[model samples]
Target chain A: MSVPFYDSGVASGLLSGILFGYVLEAAGFGSARKLTGQFSLKDWSVFKVMFTAVLVAAVGLYLLRLGGMIAGNSVYIPTLYLWAMAAGGLLIGAGFAMGGYCPGTSLVGIVSGRVDAVVFVVGMIVGTMAFAGVYEPIQGFYFAAKGPDAQRLPDLLGLPEWLILAVLIVVAIAGFVLGSRLERARGGPFTAEDVNGEDTSKAKNQNTTFNTEAGIVP
Target chain B: MTSSPRPFWPPLVAGAALGIALLISFLITGHGLGASGFVTRLSAQISGWLAPDLTTANAYFGPFLTAGAPLASWITWEVIGVLIGGYVGARTAGRSRLMVERGPQASVGQRFAFAFIGGALVGIGGRLARGCTSGLGLSGGATLAVAGFVFLAGFFIAGFVVSALVRRAWQ
Candidate 1:
């Protein structure tokens, strides 16, 4: 239950943030071209990485809870505001696809020295300020359709936690299989160089088999 | 100085590592990872400084001001760490570069415009949803929270639709 080293909230925040950011960058999520590849179906890294992480954390949390290492109420669960969450998701998804960066990934993009990412961050700040500016008029919509505090899927479905976890694992595995096939069909399994948009001109001049059309250079 | 970037880690590997990070976060902080909250707080702080009275009187920015110094929050420190960690990761992988990444057909101006517009939308949406990808999707999803799953579904569906419409920006 106690992690002596990171017991302090600040310590935990810094440590986890670093680890999270590092992994994201290493997975090539920092690259706009790469992250957006999901939309084009040219790459499945985003989906694969996201689902894998979700599964690992989900299973791990369940086990930890079962073992009583973490009290049930200790872990924070975001309150459900059905309307707000749905509307927010649509807006965020549109932004993500258009901008090719989420908040976390945008930070990663900034550190990777992408100028567009800097602009994106500025936009986020401005947007957030805009939200605050318009908060009063939209306040009702923001809090509409509120659900039970800390509503969980298992509770809603009236299913056991383990069963839900099992179903998710199966679903994730199925997705991975399908994703890999799609990638192969699309001449994918793209490298960092391909997705990062590395100097393709030089690569092309070198007579390497760079499929510009497919955006995959093997 | 111009070394080629390293290939990324296999997706599953990176995801598992990230998941472990998330797990450790729960064990330590009793919560999940986040990023937008830091931005929210930063915006609130800046707004407070610019218009203390108006900011404090607002419903959204008011609570942030009353909470204490925004920069002193936990999410703020975590975001700072994210910057450092991302830089380190990019440097080690030879992926750090100062350039505007965009589709070959897209101009630098176009990329910048989209980036800004997209970012602004994310900011508004993140606030409305009370979290972003990391906060709601990764953290809350792991906990089986209905909000997390709902956000994820909406995000992907909308993302794909928008991406298809704006395919030229990327493809």
Candidate 2:
């Protein structure tokens, strides 16, 4: 059908970001406290949403591939460079935990009116410039030990895609079950105030009664 | 044990929706999600606008210049959507807090410093790895990319370790 428009990358990028922003907003992810609370076990919304998204996408993509709607190979799967990814993740993670916002979330925070978000963003630019400055020394090592970029868990484990998808779905279900139980065990009504100080029950109820009705533990 | 009182989407529901968005992306465009790359690209544009001569001469900004589309690129528009969407989300949810988030014990200056440091690390790290948590960890992982998984694991480990070290920040 010759569907990827010449400017399609831009269109796709715009659509993708809008969808992402909607999802993040719907889930009440524009707050630093709620995000950071995930690490403290004070709130598990981030984990819940993140894992759920991964599970759904995994299952959906596998199904789409099976249906021949999307060619698995055409998708942009990154190359597996072990050291660079691990190191980069470590640094980014530290930033997330301490800063209470990742690069994306910090932008979210900015919209939510946190001055700290602006500061974090500024830091991000400086950091990027710093990376550029040192690109030469690091570039060679960063791309080193390059392995098959196509290696996925299923490929590494030599399992069928359906089986892997099934396992992931099951795991996601298990997480939901465990998370609910954990909240129940603690014994309290959940509130947006506790998570990020925003009452999302009413807002979310317009969206999903299953969660708000389920009630968060104390 | 006190149960968490914050009301938000159940993890499963939110994740599934997010996954669907990504799956839609793959089917429609043959790619996963992203954020940081565009940030770097936009930063380059700003640098260029601020200094045409230096930006053109700089080795790093060279690639983006080759692409020929300045501020009008897709990434810039997407980020604009992010701001608009985020604002809409926060306003709709009534979460528009015009305050600097810091631990009760720390001063605003101290919190700002950590945030700045942390942000810089993310900026640099995102560039080095060619993506950030969203671009690499979440989106890439969903695509079952090996690099995505590595990045995720590395990110979580680093976050958990540093969380302890910087416990006071959020405490």
lDDT of 1 at A210: 53
What is candidate 2's lDDT per residue for B1-171, written digit by digit as tens? 222233455555666777887776665666666778777987777777877777776677767776685566666666776777777776666556677877667789989999899889988888867789788888787877778878978887777688888878877
Error of 2 at A218 (Å): 5.8
Fraction of true contacts retained by every candidate, in order, equals 0.85, 0.68
TM-score of the first chain alone, every candidate = 0.89, 0.80
User: Where is model 2 more than 4 Å wrong at Cα?
Assistant: A1-11, A177-191, A195-218, B1-7, B50-54
On TM-score, the candidate that comes out on top is 1
RMSD of 1: 2.6
i-RMSD per candidate, Å: 1.5, 3.2
- What global local distance difference test value does model 1 have? 0.88
Candidates 1 onward: DockQ, in order:
0.76, 0.51
Q: lDDT per model, in order? A: 0.88, 0.73
* C-alpha lDDT (0 to 100) for residue A135 of candidate 2: 75
